[model samples]
Target: MLLSIRPSLFAILLPLLLSRHLPTAASRPAPPSDTWRSSDRFMDAERGTHVAGLSDLKRYFSRFGYLPEPDPDANPTDAFDDRLETAVSLYQTRLGLRVTGKLDAATLAEITTPRCGVPDNATLAPSRAHSVGRFAFFPGEPRWARSGPIVLTYAVSPTATIHYLPRGTVEAVFDLAFARWAQAIPVQFTKTANYESADVKIGFYSGDHGDGEPFDGVLGVLAHAFSPESGRLHLDAAETWAVDFRRERSAVAVDLESVATHEIGHVLGLAHSAVKNSVMYPSLSPRTKKADLRADDVEGVQALYGSNPDFSFSSLIESDTTDSGSAAARRGGGVRSSCMGFLLVLVLVIVI
Candidate 1:
């Protein structure tokens, strides 16, 4: 009787155990190849070259606001015309890259990087062009209007949560991300249970889920948030979003908090920054984490919202340096002991 019961119990528990450990479709790494990364072929191509794929590059330019939208009736061609040259020059200038009006290696490299869905040239006016510095704003400079000290409430969408990450973990990561911005600015952010009533709503979506900006899967567009008062932040569900880099070792895993913090900057009225080190910079590399606010970031946000009285730039730098050093030390130490211990327990449970 005892032997028969043991087999029955094993049969029941085996499926449960496998389910817990197995990777879901959402957790898996994106495909090894990306369509946008194919722009590598145009690495040395320049104006007047007329490569067969140059037309595809033109569509890419139009997507990012560098070039005007193609006419519906006209057919796109392989010609790299004067318009393409001007657009490339403008892109180089905005990103602080060498202003070469050609599709040089550096330009192509930057073009293929995973970036915020927000257009770099949104709301650009001729008069404000000269006055804008390293940091920029969304066209009319939209910002959350407030009368006094205000507390903004944000909620994670219950219907659109990611499958791999726990709901609590997502909330915690977002909480910390919001706190980082609140540390520098006078605004306060609090999590609320009400999704409908909340001032800010965040969701993870794949493909076209409405609101015009559709996610292009994997490393193409990591995420996008609407400028001020819209309070809608959407992350691509297809990417492997990792909270702990040590555990989730996928080469293409994106840092969830890093993205959250960056998008929050967008929700607060800041546009993409020319300063690469700043949080508001358009692109982020895979397997890399960058959540701290640089001086450029702080200055940009503070211009829109007054600074927090207790904020100290010197202290922030010291803290960030110390934290980075400790993180590096941990990474150099190899697999964490906790992970090893957990694996040991898992093996023991299976054996028993």
Candidate 2:
């Protein structure tokens, strides 16, 4: 049966589905590029030097799961305290940067880059918790529990702001994105003209769209997707989205296919990867295209959905022995487990 819940119901269930993911920094307007320039005074403090805004930067780092909650009773200072240094070092390490506690230019550049709207860490789960390979799962490991062969339907909103690319172009980008995943995994995604009835709903919305997570204009966050059965994927309509890098270079356009590929990973129950080269990596630079999936990406999806019959694991990389089983059995078992866990909550909602 096709699941066609109303958007309002989606909003109600949204928190439950996304309870573990942290909020992106979209609420605050992203600063201009100069704010993070190499010569900027943002990190004027020398290594082992005390500087102003350490407290503020500590709070920001905490938001991204780099640092723990600041000590409430501790006195605030401009000094680059040991706690702040530790946090900075951790952040650098996680991003695969030079592991200097100091706020160096490269670190500054990474911190300032535009990224997917999903938070770098889950609020409820610690970073790198319960992960398989480099790819992680959404808070509670929500995934489509298919017990049999199925074609998951997706629909692109006709109302999408297709200023940068025409509707047909955008549709092809999504088709390519879905095809890329299907080539590796057993699942197939088909594009449908029916918006409401589609299993996966894709659209672009600006600012407060009533889904709690609002898009900030321009270079902060490009897009975000809900995990599993929720089937909600949203792109920030404000970005200059592009499919062709050469022609759209003047606009420094964000590649629609790249973002779609990453967002679709989320739709398939894969969270952001800490591996920088992986498509699931949270950040992507302007005018950059990362449509190709890395080895880590392949291993991640295959872990969840199992590999496609024609896709050979030995041909790519000899790591884990492939588990030949029904994709539906793996997915169906997971879905049943998840439903049984949430059955009480469902009953409570219905009774009230």
Candidate 3:
């Protein structure tokens, strides 16, 4: 079957073969959609009625702030995170989502919309050039950034950028949220004077965007991030986004900065703490305010960044309450002590 006997055909095929082995002139993938993949199978574990994977729990609660304590002893058939119900009923009630806790198609659609996180990467041109606060990342690559202070940056999709608080008022509140964390956890957590100049950068993205972790459109797994050098903090652009911070005052809202602060803590290498009051708690509550960064938070950050030069905002940041900020925050509950939580950290670190 002499299919390609012509000399012209042979010549044209030679260039195609040679091009396959040539080094890419532009770095990063040409088509961003190339990274999208099937949903993480573990998501089924969060079906809410049974045994669950810790990572799956993180992915699920990430959609909301955190998952409320479930009765693990409950029947598995009714509990696990199934394709039908993305979140539990009590959870929907707490977040003011019809309080049904059951994630119907409409509810699922609302939460999995593209406005939720990152950007719609329907089209990705080789970024004309590298962005500020950007760095190199390859799968399976070992860490390279300085182990010390760092700043992470990622391209947020235009749609999801709203989550970054582009509105002046929201941005201000969001900034204050981080400032509260900075003030609260200064004992251990800190950012460099020149965050824009830090060696490490955290970039937040959305959808089946960069880093191979794709958002599963309202079904399972809201977001994911790489540790340290991965410098990638990605949100599922398909998730429902309620970046509103007036949660305590209003019916349903979320503190964008609060979650950002928590994820950034992960970028700094701190893991979740069981201490419920700590900002590092795996899940967050609608009732929680920026004022919720408790003593456990300070202890966790102080563990990584040190004190004084390493950490120093005000001893008051670690105080149980404050009178300084907004009237709404001032009237909030006073500080919560972690007597057992304190002992827990000391014990976990093997100091006591």
Candidate 4:
């Protein structure tokens, strides 16, 4: 039996069908040979174990400010150097894992986890243990000078290579992110039509696009933003950015709003927070959304720019959702479907 539907009905159902059956992380094509997969090497590097010929792991950790790179003139034969052990301990401490001086299974899992593009050593102020107020500031606490209420103009790059979500959806999510920060501060953000004229600019790019920082495709580094005055926020275009949890499904889906909120903190001159639940904390797992600004984040930003007189702090907003955020993220799911219905619409538009 043939199921017949009118062209009008087909057009109405097209987007719904495509979004419902979109590709999951498991269904997506495998990464190329050159792409880095963190989990593949962790098993061999566990806990006080000396493994030779794994300099690449040292270099990998060093690149992200995890451990300092070995001296250029140091003996090549030395494996799992002392510097790496110390750094691994520090990394474990930061992640709230056991302070194993070596690569233990738990430590390895945390280290290999996909996180924010921001470097771990980005200039954050010294943190106090167990303090929800342990928000770190960039060196010298760089912030936009606030003599009074400040209005910052921002713009999104029209040429951004964002394929997973619609450009308007991206902008809307960003607007909400900025608004979250604005609710707590004296600063007001205005979206400008001109990208060049805007004080802060946001865009998504794939590889090296000339701004010193190059994006490594997918999972590794999701996005990064400049501290204060620089006002450049960049997201990896290669990511499967999910704008809505239910609407846009993917196993490796990253919440655009969550990342935008974090990067926005950078735009406002905030550094990574020591508090794991704070929005400023570096590293986010896949398929999760964390847009809520925590007390630590609020305190940090307010310290820079005094709290907004009109804003009221409610317990409803103060409750942290970090654990729930990670719980919602998973790396593997079901099958994927083709987007033939979408392509048909695009072809019609081109013809017209």
Candidate 5:
């Protein structure tokens, strides 16, 4: 049956439904040797630190969304060295890194390479592929479905392993990621990690690392993940990953938590959503936050999972669109229907 509905609104209900893997943060060339030497005092930019001189450094990074502590550094940048005490204090607050401001293992990785970015997921080569048959989303919702899970017997790739952090913390991040997805849609799924089993495995990697994609340098790329196939996800070893937030910014803004959240969405069987209000939108609008999920993100996922027969008026959030753009294109005739939704107000996530 041929059918189509405005996924923008649907995104609110099932945030992961037909989501898009968005391209975020423009690729940047290697930074000059003196990236650390320059400093304008992050104080004016935002109220990140209470200290006037050094504490401001930590506050600045916090505002930028880099975890408070990063990996320790070996060769501290000259500017940071000049402000050594202050830099070290700032370093300790953010990343668990050495706090020396010199590039260490984790700190060097983040400084010389990107810690987080979008993933270059594999394409579902349509020309020659086997269909597992058809599974339909609930009636009136064609864009969502629960793709039955498949377990990997192992060795799908000779060289494959999870990247970044201790197993426990990684698992925690992954678990929270799923919970966020559940908030968007009620797939109500569960997971268990088995480094020993063929089903799901978790660990670290580098650019062109495992998959075809390769990291260029510090800000060139972040990381990538695959669909929930074999429960596989790839992280760029180049990333200076830390539970603590810290960033290696280039031309554009890239947040670790934000990109991680998006990649996890892909692992849950969602594609890209065009609606700007949706977290599934490929590029993160500077206006959006690293932690908050959008209505479209929530709705798109709901499409995959069946909705409760018992409903509530609170589920609706009105889109602020008028008779314009794609909204008009889908309406073949003049037949008008003001979509029943909640008027979005006082929120960071956009809803269309």
Candidate 6:
């Protein structure tokens, strides 16, 4: 049976069909790096209980610096021993979760969430404690040591690039991400064409691309950056990185700007923040965007690099409120428009 469709109806139907078939993050199978997802099987597990896959959970703890790396030669045991319990307690404490020393649902959920590749507690010193405040720094409190006005050059890797997003789009996102930090601190970031010589080098990489810390495909580890003068920022190319949530309607699509901003914080020497609202916070959920720096982030950065003369907490708060309100309005309008279009398409389909 052949049904004739008018040009107007065809236009609407064609877009819907194309969109439906478009490859999305949700459509893609879970990446191998998501092995932590299996940690849920050990939910509510405490010390003295031996679960089959508890060794994998121990690897997760070791990966994030909660527990020391196990000996490669020795076989890893699945026992939920005292060491594992202590590691779980430390992890919870670092993330501001309840320090129960058990694999509670909340702890498991956090374990499974996508987070930065950088260790939460990297070479911790006795003086620098996570309990001190929401913000933290690398062991030595690394900062770009410059006498005069701190100006750092950053460049994206020409060779290691993502095919999905345009080079210009990626560059612009990083530019804005750098600008956000500039607004808060005295440091100025300048984009450079010289990838090798640039103070900060950014790249999109797949599994095991040097730097010791390999990219764990997809949501496991979205990105990681080095502290201070190290000047390295790498994003996992396997991730469904999205610049706009509206256009890229993937269930697991991660906001590129948000990740970029957070990694830039690492490059600036701020470690994972306990404050969930701060960009430096370790875990970021899929389909969620948070680029703006909160008070904790600002204070942390300012401590390292003195505040920008024009910057003020009140001004930032006002700007954030205005931006949030506008974004909410846009989302509301988009929903209404989409509903109207869907209803119109339904009516046309019925008539045809």
The lDDT of each candidate is: 0.72, 0.65, 0.38, 0.66, 0.38, 0.72
Candidate 6 TM-score over all chains jointly: 0.76
Q: Write the per-residue lDDT of candidate 1 for residues 228-266, one digit (tens) a residue.
A: 899999998767788987888765568899899999999
* RMSD (Å) of each candidate, 1 decimal: 16.6, 18.6, 21.9, 15.8, 21.0, 14.2
- What would the per-residue lDDT of candidate 5 be over residues 1-352, giving only the tens digit for each residue? 1012232433232222212122222332222232222233211112211222223333334323332333356322213334444544344333333555432233322222223333211121112122321111112332323356322332122234333344555555656665666554545535544355543343345434455545433333455555554355555443334444223222233444556677666555555443433455444322123444555555545445544344332543443233335333422222112111111211212422
Error of 1 at 97 (Å): 0.6
Point to the candidate with the largest lDDT.
6
Better model by TM-score: candidate 2 vs candidate 3: 2
How far residue 316's Cα lies from its native spot in candidate 1, in Å, is 4.8
Each candidate's number of clashing pairs is 1, 1, 31, 1, 73, 0
Tens digits of per-residue lDDT for model 3, 1-352: 0112133343332222211111121311121332234335223211211112323333444434444434457522322344323444433433234645443323333332212222211122222133321121112223324455433333333333433234444334434544654553332233343434543333334455556555544323434545555455554433323444332332212345556666555555454443334455444333234435555565555444444354454563545454435424533232122233333333433431
Which pairs clash inside model 4? 47-103
lDDT of 6 by residue, 1-352 (tens): 1213344555445343212112433463343352223443212211111112567677778888988888999767766689987998888888878778865545555665678999998345324433335788898888998878899999999988877788899999999999999999989899999999999999988767889998655466789999988999999877778888778665557889999999999999999877666788898767677888887788888888888999989965665446445444333111121234345455667777
Superior candidate under TM-score, 2 versus 6: 6
Better of 5 and 6 by TM-score: 6
Worst 10 residues of 6 by lDDT: 42-51
Q: Name the candidate, 1 or 3, with the larger lDDT value.
A: 1
lDDT of 5 at 214: 52
